[model samples]
Target chain A: MTEIKTETDPSGLVYVIGTEEEGMSWIGKESTPVEEPYAIEIRLIEHFAEGIEDPNPLYWSDEYAQQTRWASRIAPWGVIVLCKEHKVWRPEWMEDSGGQDTFFCSTPLPGNKLLATDYEVECYVPLKPGDNVFINEKIIDIKPKTFSLGEGHHITVENYFRNQNGDLCIKDSRTVFRYR
Target chain B: MQLPEIKDTYYEDVEVGDEIPEISIGPLSHTQFLFIASSHHDWYPGHHDVEYAREQGLPDIFMNATWQHALFQRVLCAWAGPNAIPRRIKYRMGKPIVRFDIVKARGVVTGKRIEKDECLVDLDIWLDKQDVDKVTKGSATVVLPSKG
Candidate 1:
């Protein structure tokens, strides 16, 4: 076992490497817009609501959403949390350490934590039904460290949201791990 | 919605290898997404668009990992009934759970032990997407009131 030391980061770590220098080339670059739009139709949105066991009428009722000044039936917050697109790329060292199968390989902290240390979100505009939205992501920073469990590092990534009308919806800053 | 009744489960009543009832969830609708996005204020477009998802090189708009973790509690609560508190849940990302996707939570009783008045039911749980393999898997330990 490798003896590790904790860095000055708020969360102590046993291992650490900076990802910004290695992976920040794509930062601020917009990905090519998709040719075929990923349709988030009303019916599909309704189905997603039911799947998550969400009971709010605004997400299922157009009339309710319209009354509330929302653009359309809204997507679930959990959907964004579950999304896999533009996720932080794992560093080569981290991947080499465990390869494919491993236990507790990664822990991506929610960007919402940046807004509030306790993991809460700040609402700007509600995504309504039929509202077309786009997501853009970038790796902003990285910090390596050693923890009691062993050696690990933290990676922070930023994401931006834009609606069809090109409105800034949300900005997210999230953190993840690359452990040894 | 009224809370489900708390089922009285005893350590003696549960055994290793017993399977929990399977649950089917979803057809996640746009409105549901809106309500969820608005409530959680997530407002991320990749969550509601496949175009954005493809741009990001993903199969579809994926579910938020953290939100899924939180909602998993509801699934556990439903199965364990009201009295059980979700102690700790950990998961890694798999495939994105999309709209109209029906997911199920199943568990095998891994072990059971008694701690005074508390009957601990150790379960190995999985949140699997219907018609597909498992999306996320983890272990949970719930403390149920014992039948003393």
Candidate 2:
């Protein structure tokens, strides 16, 4: 396979084009919402803690989690964001208008907290090692907005997390961008 | 808890195509979710709201792509250990990850080279089910401990 190089910014920042925004515009414009599901494993928890500079005992301490309300080691929100395999290809129907340099540009400028950049998490039950879970995702809504950088758009993608037993865990809304 | 102990090694010690140790994670509960949620302070009931998710045309609430991407990087974190600082990591959101999902994340040393003090290790990271191909795969560059 050919190596795809990341783009570099003038300020020496690098952009990893993990998610090729191909058919995203279609989902943003003409397509109906889409959904997908995945299985989770113990490794995910370890990754979660590594992301946010947190290595607290509770995360790995089974006894600690059992004693606490959490009842088990949980992952960090940053880990969730980072866990996504960004290089996954966009749907065949989706076309790429362009891409973003995530390193230098914070496309969704950190404001409005949840509203500006929507986030959601649900704990159906505490997860422990040796158990399997599932994740279901949907491209629910898309909205276009024009900012100082000309015409741009935002995507409202939703996700549902559950265990093999079919219990609900979490639902999330992610915003993707297309800016000039 | 402390990160798993990994021995230090130069890039020369790492051979291409070597499989880094796989890591296990999760089985989170409400309080665990709250701890993560409280830090970022970014939560939408739709993520946790079953009724809302169904209303929005989803089966149930799932994890965010960003979080999943971060979780996947732990494979690299374990391999690179303390000497390595993650320079780049990227993954795409294919499916939603519900609570209790057993996420199997791993890494392979795809490329390695030395640059003065920084011994670079290029790895291909993956997150998958116990018996599946791969859900997410991406490349990562880590600055490993130097031989010098």
TM-score of chain B of each: 0.83, 0.79
DockQ comparisons of all candidates to the true complex:
0.04, 0.03
Expressed as tens digits, the lDDT of each residue in B52-125 for candidate 1 is: 55654557666665556545555554566433444444454456677777777777778887766557777777
Task: Encode model 2's per-residue lDDT on A67-131: one tens digit a residue.
Answer: 54345565433433333333234787877433222211222322111212333333334444543
Q: Best TM-score goes to which candidate? A: 1
Clash number for every model? 48, 69
Best by DockQ: 1
Name the runs in model 2 displaced over 4 angstroms.
A1-180, B1-6, B28-31, B115-117, B130-133
Docking class of 2: incorrect
True-structure lDDT of candidate 2:
0.49
